[model samples]
Target chain A: MLDRMKQMQAALDRLPHLRRMGALFSETVLIKVDGQEFYLVFEKGRIAQLLEGPSKKTPYRFSFVTDEDAFEEFWTATPKPGFHDIFAMVKIGRAEIMGDILLLVKNLRFLKEVLALPRARREVVE
Target chain B: MTIEQITGRYLTVEVAGRAQRIYFEEAGQGRPVLCLHTAGSDTRQWRHILNDPAITAENRIIAFDMPWHGKSLPPEGFMQEEYLLSTKAYMETVLAVIGGLELNRPVLAGVSMGGRIALQLAVHHPESFAGFLAIEASDFQPAWYDIDWFHRPDAHGGEMGAALVSTNISPYAPDTERANTLWMFMQSGPGVFRGDLSFYTQDDSLVGQLHRIDTAKTPVHFIVGAYDFTCTPEDARRTAEQVEGATLSVMDEVGHFPMSEYPEAFRPFFVDGLARMPSAGAGAS
Candidate 1:
């Protein structure tokens, strides 16, 4: 899991378009995987820190929670229909997005692609 | 590249008591297959099937750009009102094009919105066509995404449509075809995608009406991609199970835009399904 998160960070660093899209973005997003929660704090477009949760002070702009199996399925090269996309998982009741949707909608493509970094191969990432 | 096998032409059809010029393209020389594209897109979706000699040799692949889409222009009256496609208007235009062309009971093949309309045709006008090919379609799939974003001034319509569509497609689609699908959607006209959705995402449904489709008289076949969560294979399976003589197949590594996003993978199904449809009856319902 740590390796994949590192891979995601590395890939995001290389993609210029994502950064540009979220140039005005600066907010923390709480991510819950199964029973574990992680604070993904972002300054502008770059992720500032990935703090393991149970922290009481970090206020997030939004939250993206996923079932462990759904997250695993989503990380696959070619995920199944309901598990292929974040929105797909949401529609099928496997994923949830809570809190203010303004930033989320504004950078929908960005957030979606960012969460999908683990699946995007090295060749496609560059 | 000097000469092309496909030919494009424009014909005048009267819809809503006004003369409308509609553009359509055709290839091959045998039985006619009327192709319909998804919302926010045009006839170019069928380009691959038309170019494939194997499918074209036995089928006359005909595709048309609905009014205000692709090469088809909107009627005169210059932009006083917003364009929103209703079921009645959609049905009228489809019938007008078919009647104006005087096609002898062509088999109808459509994807997405086209696929939904094909389901409508099967229920209400079964005798009009030989068979119905509803790809990535089912009885009803609600518009789960934000519809206002499609034409909102703050958002770029082209980019939004292309981006949303990009997510719906299978990752296995070839890069070129994926690029083509995005490009075609990006070129959509203003309010076009939203207007097209007016009919597709409406509160209406064909759930109970599907029983009216007599497959022996006019076959109804469904080919849904496994990656399409909107109109999942499970949805098509449920619909097919209820209708006698109806058939369905779930394809892996394919998605919403099967006919466009991955025509290579979609070819075998198109060809085999093409043979399943018989000739149409004398009159259209």
Candidate 2:
């Protein structure tokens, strides 16, 4: 999952203008998975800083769990899930979303497209 | 039902007096991402992207069958309407499905015909979508009507005036896979073809509407296939240029179906675009 996150971050870094024009341009994005979470700050589209400590001051935050089995089902299926089901969980309190709602919505399409990338898959152990 | 169960089940919703069942697979948990399919195809086109690691790692995703395609059955009287009405009906059905599922302001990602639907929704129902991802879409070029071939009689003529609506799915599939692929289209029958052609011909001077979209509240990103013959990359670029704050990315060596043809390249472009969106609580001005 961390590797996938890095790969995604790296992909974003490649787009210079996207970083410059981002809504939280210089702020750190605090991401939580399972019980662990970390903050990674991006400036000018590149990772400018990283913070591992628990800090509640970050301006942006998002969190989600990666269930390997569920992830596999999504990938292998022919007609996969749409935006409705994904967010329905959050709306119903089955899923948790932290931080700014408007910013999340603003970048909603961007987040969907990012998740659509193949490299976003979780690592499977044999 | 659990998130997994809700997403896993092949759910049905009534739209335009017809019950359409849509199949879906979901991951993560956050704002919904509605995936719309292209002409002659169903939700299956988004399979690769839906399961992409980048997507699952961050947000939840859903891809569904359009009316009369995939596991869903065509509505009664499906063939009675023009393409524009058909599209409008399908869009309404999609909205109903979303509402039935109980989601709010989903992000829309559509390809080809689906992309066109996304643009229309953005213009007509701006509040329903958080943003949109359009691949190989167009606002309908003015010269589209100038071509004399479209007005001629026969299937090819229908191709020009209306979008390419053919029950002959054989032409679209690899020769080895033609027989199996054609079955879906064959079942859809002539009504699907007629409705699709009508959608292709509807007046789509969306440029004026594009100017009216609230870009500050709803951002759009367009991904164009460099060699896409259906909706020229230039048209996608032009649309992007017109929408304030909209972003455009031209995928080289690719055609209209980037998600299917090159998932690796396509995934990153889309993922990066998402990461660029303003995080929630950024507030709308």
Candidate 3:
């Protein structure tokens, strides 16, 4: 799982459009995979830090909470309902988003593309 | 709930001065509804609606295959060439069917390419339809996704476009449903998919035309699937907001083909939209 997250981070780093869209985003986004947590600190549309574990020193502005299984399904090359997308999962009560609406909506596409990185990687591997 | 029995028939209709044999299906017996299919898809997309006992009990549900689509054969002398669907010809065909059938101000429900035409039909002939229900439609595609690669022949000289679309179906869809969707995609004739895209992505531009929509005359409702990347919920909402009295709803856990992708899951939203239509008959509304 950690390796997969790392791969996703690497994919996000290489997405050119994310870099352009990320210009509007600058915050620490938290992703809770089951009980574990990670922080993706964005700096000038780039993932400055993919910090593993929680930080008593730093705070996350937004967070997504989902189980490891749901997260895996979401990142799979092809996903089914209850896993196809963040919004889809939210509708089926599998995932939750906790954060400012303005921030999320402002960078919705960027965040969606970033989260979809693993799918792109999976496709390439297939 | 009991499933309604669906009956299909082929009617000879005059379209663009040509006598065309069109295939159509219907169920239930109430206010009439003319359902249209998505691009490269046939009446099968509305199987759920056509078979829903609740909808059928209260509404006359009808679905038809466009010329050059499904069981409908291409026009004479054009069978050897690629089937190209132009907006003008598409609309003319639809209008001809309505007139030939003498459907009285029936409610119009459509998806993708069908949805775009519903909007056009409403604008040009508002009094013709009681209400419009459009899914996966917008004024225009904001950007062309470069669909040329879809038509490129594979190693076996077969177009891979349909295969590409088959993959986009939500992974969570029922195995049988997914298989059916792939079957529909595979059944399409060569260049038919691209021909439909030409209208979906290019010829049909509803931009600056939303103002012409009179909700008082014909209420328009837009429903977009949550997982539809081609037409996002945000885009549908934005487009719906422009027209007065037009409502927008997002179907969750659904993708590009909501009704066919997950019929049971999609029926509630469909029913809800139908209920919102004032002209919908007593039991339906």
- Tell me, by TM-score, which candidate is best: 1
- Clashing residue pairs in candidate 3 are A80-B171, A80-B172, A81-B172
lDDT of 2 by residue, B1-285 (tens): 622222455777887776777666666666577777766556555666666655766667887776656666665665664333355676797788778777677778887777777887878887777788877777764332223333223333322222222111111223223333333333443345445545655646465777776777778889886545556567798877777888888876455566654565567777866665544334422
TM-scores for the candidates: 0.90, 0.55, 0.69
Please give the range of 10 consecutive residues that has the lowest summed lDDT in model 1 chain B: B276-285
lDDT of 1 by residue, B10-53 (tens): 99999999788999999987788999999999999888887888
Please, what are the lDDT tens digits per residue for candidate 2 over residues A1-126? Answer: 456456557776676555554534354556454445556675644556655545666655454433433333323322122111224323233335566643443444334333333232333333
Candidate 3 error regions (>4 Å)? A1-73, A76-126, B1-4, B142-144, B152-159, B166-168, B280-285
The DockQ of predicted model 2 stands at 0.01
Q: Largest lDDT belongs to which candidate?
A: 1
True contacts kept of each: 0.30, 0.00, 0.12
Per-residue lDDT tens digits for candidate 1, residues A1-126, read: 546656666777888898787677788888888767888777778877878877778899889888788888898876777787777888789999889865576567678788888884524442
Looking at model 3, residue B270 earns an lDDT score of 91
> Candidate 2 chain A, which ten residues in sequence have the lowest lDDT sum?
A77-86
Q: Model 1 off-target regions past 4 Å? A: A24-27, A41-44, A48-51, A120-126, B1-4, B279-285
lDDT (C-alpha) at residue B141 in model 3: 69
